[model samples]
Target: MNLALKDIRHGLFRFVLTCFGLGLLMTVVLAMIGIYNGLVADALAIVKAPAADVWVVEAGTQGPFAEASSIPPDTRDAVARMPGVAAAGAITYQTLEASHAGRTLRVYAIGYELGRPGGPEQIAEGRGIATSHFELVADRKTGLLVGDTLRLGRDRYSVVGLVEDATNTGGDPAVYVTLADALSIQTKLDPAAARVQAARGAEPVKRPTVAAVIARMEPGADVGLLVATVRQWKHLGALTEAEQEELLLVSVVDKARRQIGLFLGILLTVSAVVIALIIYTMTMEKLKQIATLKLIGAPDRTIIGLIVQQALILGGSGWAIGLALILTVKDNFPRRVELEPFNAIVLAGIVFAVCLASSGLGVRAAMKVDPATALGG
Candidate 1:
């Protein structure tokens, strides 16, 4: 007879209740892993959207995602004329809050020239922006739909298309418009600000500048050569796509990653402690039975097997429950929760190791129960 299974069946309700509680704890651990993955994904979304090989920005600054960067609008033309350059587009980025559908919507506005490399690669719904003046392609996360019009700055723009999962590092949904319209929206001051500027007799603001110029190189082109050529322009800095992604991971989300890792460590420690304590307590409650088995000449291995088996069942059941819960509710999270199969597999391995380690305490307690204890009590 399996002593562990028999004991668990004797207290099935309690065993299930304990597993439920541990399941909740495991849910939190899995969620943290997913949230960390989501943070990295969100931070790199915009940079990867354009699929450009080279990014040119104002000299002495990182690309637009990390810090402020503004280069001349004509930078695109200069880069396009360089050898090995297949295409180039000047793009601007800004974060703005606008009133929409009785709520304030925060969005990251992107300006790209028509017939350029910076536009959205595919439209999920409707059509791409065809007009230069007031059309937009918005991320579906912005709650925008085709034919919906929203006022931005001094003019109104109509949504012509929708894209999925397009967001900036700050998690704001992205909207795409023509370069001219973006410049117009960005430069036009509100009436109150305009009045203040008029009172000061400030000269009209110069034409709005672009955040960066992105270039796509021809197949088999020397990316290093193009980056070097852009860097020698005296007023421009260039980074390849890999360098830009590294900069973002190191600069933009490094602290968040560290924070999540710390939390995961803490949670795992707590889980080990809780499992050890639970097993120890269960062993203490069954000391007499263990003594009886010893008196009947049961071997030490049988007793050890009982403790280890119970711990594994508890941990394995809890982990399975937690995985199910997280998968069901992951999509409802405000920010993305990207859980991969590999992440789940790694967690399972960690939990298995913890279970084995935790059973040591119960094993120790069961071994100390003297065979005489069963004769006395």
Candidate 2:
């Protein structure tokens, strides 16, 4: 006769209700883990999109993503002429808000030269930008579609293509345009502003600048040598892809990672406390039955097994329910929720350890029940 199973069957309704509540709590814990993974992925999305071997930016600054960087638009030609350079492209980055279809859309605007290394790698729908000006390739998250024309600055641009998972570190969807169009959109003045400038007799704006120049090296080329060569130019700074990613993680999203980790720690501590309390309460409620078993000469191991078994069942059932709930609703989350297999496995292990540690309280209380208590009460 399994005393733990018999007891649970007797109070099946209460057991199910308790598991349901714990399942909700577990769902929150799993969601936090997924959210942290998503944050890291989102932070690195743009940096990884280009797949460049080296980044060239204004001297004395980190890459364009971390801080302001501007280089001459013609820097692409100079980098391309360097030995072992397979390709180079000038690119610019900016954030803009534009009104469209009765709503304001915020986007991260990217400018790249045609047939360059900085454009979207693949288009999920429609074709890539075919014209040098007034054409746009937008991320699907932006809610813009092919043939949809939106006015930006002094000119209008038509959405010619759509990409997936293209967003900046700030979670804004990305839009791509030719270098010429992006410069015009970014530097052009409104009619009123242009008139004021003319009245002041100010000279026309100088040629627009690019945020950075990205270069792809030939296969088996020495990346360190190229970086060093660019650094010696005095007006330019260079970083390999690995260094750029590290700078972004350390400078851009480091605080967010720390905050989420602290929150996860708090949640796990609370879960352990709640499980311990629940097991202790259940053990107290069955003290007389435990005493009866002791009077009938049941060994200490049997009583210990009963408490431990019940604790495991509660925790295991709750974790299973929570995993199901998270998987079903993860796609609906505003930001991505990336739940890898390793993350789930690690969480399961933590939960198992928590269950065992929590059962200690119940085991301690059950061991103290006097055999005489059964006869009296």
Candidate 3:
């Protein structure tokens, strides 16, 4: 008795094809949403990996991640002497390109005190750097496995461990080494360049510096008060774990987030337009049936229900298809794609509302089709 169901069944093949095409569009929309979530997660990965209570950097700067910060390596020992500081470690950061197995990989280099506050929280394979020098803990994304040795700077390092999701805000996998090794690589002069400089009566610059000094507070210690005390030091700046995350999100990845949001907005708008046009055309093709129903004294609500029902069916089916498509290939993306349950549910609600709203166009056109059209046909 339902006109929409009857018509859809009569043209089932066309209806399915339409849904499949619409599903591809929905998949694109869902992928955009996943990409934005992934961007935020990726940006926070390394920042959250270290289990430190507070971060201390150079004075007058938001160093470590947001900006360049080079503090005396001894700062770690000094910070450890402060009240309420249980432990401290010096950490350094830099970007380096290395080649392995005929492929070049961009890596974010992190130097930290061994067995300290700055090491990765979780290791998926092997063990943390046990030998100190020339032993590295690498993110699995770097395509390096345990026992695999790669060259960085002038030194060769063996991959001793692999960590998951340990990448920097820039989406490069992180490689961890001892503070001493990192300093040597980052600050050491190239041998050829050093010789040229020496010939010119210049000494190789060797400033012992670390990007930041990380501190862990004792049980029930006040992080705010500790940060305040650290900041009182003329040569130091400090922030809590929360503040560090905020700095990365609000400053480091802010532009990329805005760009992704704008792109998502455009895709949603286009989806609405496409849905409206599809419903309108489908309604146009059913004009004769609409006129026949009107001639038989069917009420306006019944005609409206027919168009709305068809629109919902199409949208619901498309959403399902899109979900499948996105899941099948989500892992294939170069960057991470995180599709959370909350986001998917929220998108579903919006899609349903759009479906109902789009049906209005079809209902309006169907209502205007004169009953006299049935007589002519």
Give candidate 1's TM-score.
0.96
Which portions of model 2 miss their true places by more than 4 Å? 204-207
Query: Relative to the unseen true structure, what is the C-alpha lDDT of residue 136 in candidate 1, on a scale of 0 to 100?
Result: 93
Residue pairs clashing in model 2 are none
TM-score of every candidate = 0.96, 0.95, 0.96
- Scored by lDDT, model 2 comes in at 0.90
Report lDDT (Cα) of residue 317, candidate 1: 91
Question: Can you write out model 3's per-residue Cα lDDT over 1-377, one digit (the tens) per residue?
Answer: 88889989999999999999889988998898888788889877777777888999998898788889989999988889888899999999999999999989999999999877898778899999887699999998899999999898889999999998887877788999988899989878888888888898877756779999999999988899989988898789998989988998999889888998898889888888888898999999989989999999999999998999999999888888988899899888777888988887887888899989999999989989999999963
Of candidate 1, the 10-residue stretch with the lowest lDDT total is 198-207
TM-score winner, 1 or 2: 1
Could you say which candidate leads in lDDT?
1
lDDT, candidate 2, at 262: 96
Residue runs of model 3 more than 4 Å from their true location after superposition = none
Question: What is the RMSD of candidate 1?
Answer: 1.5
Q: Is candidate 2 or candidate 3 better by lDDT?
A: 2
- Candidate ranking under TM-score, highest first, comes to 3, 1, 2
User: Where does candidate 1 clash, by residue pair?
Assistant: none
| Cα error of candidate 1 at position 356, Å | 0.6
